[model samples]
Target: NAMEGRVEIFMRNEWGTICDTLWDSKDGNVVCRSLGYEGFTGVPRYNSFYGKGSGRIWLQNSSCNVDETSIQNCIKSGIWVHQCNHSNEAGVKCVPIRLVNGSSIDEGRVEVYQYNQWSTICGQNCSDSEAQVLCHSLGFGRAMNINATAFFGEGNGDILIQNVNCKGTESSLLDCGKDDVTVQNCSHHYDVGVKCSSVRLVNDTHEWEGLVEMYDGGAWKGLCAQNWNTAEARVACRSLGFDGSTAVTQPFKMNQRIKAKFPTYFDCRGHERNLFECSHHRIPVKTGWYSNDECTQAEVRCIPVRLSGGYSNKEGRVEVFMNNVWGTICDAGWDSVDTRIVCNTLFGYSYGGTKVSAGHFAQGVGDILLANVSCTGSESNVLECKHSLMTDHCTHSKDVAVKCYQNIRLNDGKLEVYVKNEWGTVCTYGWDDADAKVACRSLGLPRYYDLKDNKKLP
Candidate 1:
């Protein structure tokens, strides 16, 4: 074979070697022409054959794009068997068929290709949470529906898993498994089918969490905490082109918070490109406050982030309901308490000390809009700014964006945090005692102040 994978060849007549240089799709065409094979798949790599012969005539090379006759011309001195056995033969593998359909197969469900075959797995231990993960892995949004007991009719393939430890929202199927084990305690009666969901952009809210999809790549940004009004918030939301936002909330301490994540504010013009491509600014802080009631109108921006877009690498959409518009929040106020709201809203879990920010630290955009924007500890919307504007040469044009955590999954089974637009895997190795005390205190949990894990220094 001439091109695609790496290989060496020697001609039977000259015992000389030649290396394939012209490797391309054209080479693949030649392969099909000489082989009389229909439908060109693509060039695969890896030595297809290992040549073994006497002195130097170890192998023969030909352009993959050549016809059988052209290949014959390359070796006029002698004719080698078309399928001769050798140790140094060029090798290539046909690519596996990629299933374009976005759907999930459950514990027992099975489907047959053109080939009439059948196989099934036991759904005895499959849970909806686990099913959510499996479905998402299949290029679908979270699983919206699940059917079991041969729902799709039994088909074939090894019952690959059993007693799966699925967490429903896992990023991948392998994450739930124990090392190399597969097909755990499964039975023939378990068959499952999943309904894949589509991705949709969402804004942040007190009761709900929004996902971050894209990043602007700079300092962690902050939102305008000045005497903002709902009108400005709406403009910002519209500027970022978010469908709309829920009640704006004042950012509190997120237990799993990381410092300097996300932009201050987002500016979407509804007609602009996605959020990542839209223009954004920062919210300046002064005198422990954003802007005073001196300004009436301010501009904001947004980015279109996909929540369940089948791109695990992509962050979820995480926006804060700042002003009336949905703006990105900086990780400025992120602390254990703030992360508590995120975990509770997204994972339906009881608050675990906001685990370490197990996600990327989105560069911050600006400082918090207000140093002490008064909140009843639960006020939504950062506009209740009573503090005076802290900046000098700032205007609505310099409004900062906000960042949020759409969803985060942590090491403690359900511990999670948001940083930038991405979710991070928390580090358990270096977590120490002082951090624990800070975390516990942030959660309003009585400081254990005694346990080894909760030890305090000085």
Candidate 2:
């Protein structure tokens, strides 16, 4: 009564109806808007969708332009009509369809409103074209798959429509060509469902590594890690616009408590545009797999990290981009071994560099990512280093820094120095080849052959 069908008006203190001669969604939209509903699409009903009214027919052959505000302003003669009867009563749905029982907003079973009740669409003869329209109408890109056998789960009430033939270009499912409403001949077990490519990574600050959630059948459901592997993770990373997943970890802890549903196990060949394209077991049957538990949560980590705020390209304050934002690392227990991994990964320097602290270069602006970082000096990246989870106890004043010696060079045979990110000649006041040899060795160059007086060199 509030959201679906039956256009009625009050006249002479009695409820009346309108004629269905020219009723449509455009006309229904005005009524729905008048009732204070947004994003409303009106479905025209011919045979008194609400019920047969007992009073005079107040409007007949009502025509409304899209911009018109009210049905009262849609009469042909701008006057109430008494020429129509209750038999020709018109009805309209303010909000006709919705996705229900799914994991996310863009996914769910297709439900349509008719006869003042919600009904499911039969999976019989349902196709991608029909699903495309449904997904697009729900503000999703397109339909990833049309599940015919109630993949999301069965629905209650009547099977409203069957054999829906959509051209894939329609705005709504009602716009698609379909059989008459009276020809309902399908069962609830054959209820139609849709899966959209609206995927998200939750819990972790990094975009790549987190609990994987997919929008399906009307809600956000977690993906199970039963058969999840690096191949599947790679596909997920590629889907999210990354090169590929570096690691596929299972049972990753979620920051917030969640009642995860739909334990889907993916079987991927390492290449698929979306997760749904990968063959999957909708409900995994692994031992100890719980449908409503977080233990089955699967996570993936994509490789994305950088060194910033250093004097040279080889070294600086370490920052990682995750959850669509950049953040720095804390120096709580930072050391040379931890800084070595970052220097090796970015600068290709075999020897480990020195660890600087207290924002040696300058303070970073955002989050202090890692605290108590500890590496074995053999890791390829700083992410491989063991570190405490970021906490508010650390601040930018304790931001970690590194000074890599990879950029040191001699300029014009002079004992030039490169520190604090600049090039200048060493004072040479204390002058000896032993000091020169040590400097040359630090620069990874051959030992100095001779030490000449500064006047002789000049």
Candidate 3:
């Protein structure tokens, strides 16, 4: 069973015999690879494990030289076989698949919204850096939990394919995808998972305003390991525009690996231009007894933060301070529904209809945290808003700020259709009738209008 195979393969609704011409171990490798196997364990020979099938075409003559993707491409056309119906199913069996050097989903790894499905990391070109980030996201410390097989456990259900192409500069494993320019296969293993911990790093600020020291630099320092608390973490988080610190890491657990720039100690609030613009203070060793190694190795806790642009309503304007500049909210596209949510968030909207309104309600252009906010009538704040595009020549001065006009009732059911620059009400008046006929038939609703004319008025 090492050089000859007597199996009838189906192709082009015909059955044929595969000659031994151009058959060798290299061709065998192509077949195995196409079938999701690592490589050819042995060549097809006499008494080899052959596949039997009931289909359109059977017994294919194959010639393989390159990394063929499917078995159909490996073989040539063969004789016509009897058509196969569902009553008879094609069956094929081979030696048990063994796990090799690869990555697989762990026993209890659950993706965010991907449900309970598990996948294997494609083996085309997986690197140790990707392994490190993936391990950390899964709650493992660093790349200490790298595995070459489905060691954690075999995944159930459909085998998902995750092609990870790391350039070594990606901050996280998920950022990588199957790039079209260069294609590779990670089908070496059927299932893959990762084991991770929360061993992450924490840095000082976002933008590097001046001569701020980096992680290993001895000049700047962090809080001593002496009984760090959530309050300290909260303060540090707020300083960096974060909602609060999610977790605090103790000594011996911090990531001090200086390999990659990020996986560095601070994920900034916004995509900052530099690293020192954030607000957390750094400990400068002016005259204190400190060494470079001492500063880098000292037990400093990390404050993982949930971040956002901070905004609050004052008087009648939504105000936010960023980059040390305080600015007001613009209401260029603000409306009652948008303001209703804002009122509920800022002040309880128990007064109902009279609590929030929007009109001449524009705030002087402040630092534009955001602009051109399109509300589907379900959002809370402009900071949390999303727009179609950045808009043309958008300066912070052209940014609209919002402040809810007092006394407004929330309107839900009625659709707010845009017709002009100012939101004019489409009165229920003349909402019926010939008006619709003029609009519809004017635009070619002849069939609909003809049907109405063919019948009498009900």
lDDT of each: 0.36, 0.66, 0.36
- What is the Cα-based lDDT of residue 391 in candidate 3? 41
Per-residue C-alpha lDDT of model 1 across residues 1-458, encoded as one tens digit per residue: 33233333435445432222122223334444444433322332212223333334232334433343233334422444332233323333222111122222112242211122222335665667866665454333444445566665654465654555775556555577532234555544565554433222234542222322222121112333333344434333332323333323122333232223222344444332223223333332221222332321222323222122112422232333333233333333344444344334333333442323313323323332332233332422233323333344433232322123244433454345657865566566877667655555444454545445656444
True lDDT of residue 163, candidate 1: 55
Candidate 3 structure quality by residue, lDDT tens digits, 267-318: 2443222232222222222213222333232232322211122242322444
Cα-based lDDT at residue 276, candidate 1: 20
**RMSD (Å) of each candidate, 1 decimal:** 24.7, 21.1, 26.1
Worst 10 residues of 2 by lDDT: 242-251
Clashes of each: 105, 13, 58
- For the record, the alpha-carbon RMSD of candidate 3 to the native fold, in angstroms, is 26.1
Off by over 4 Å in 1: 1-119, 156-160, 167-171, 178-189, 201-458
TM-score, candidate number 3 = 0.23
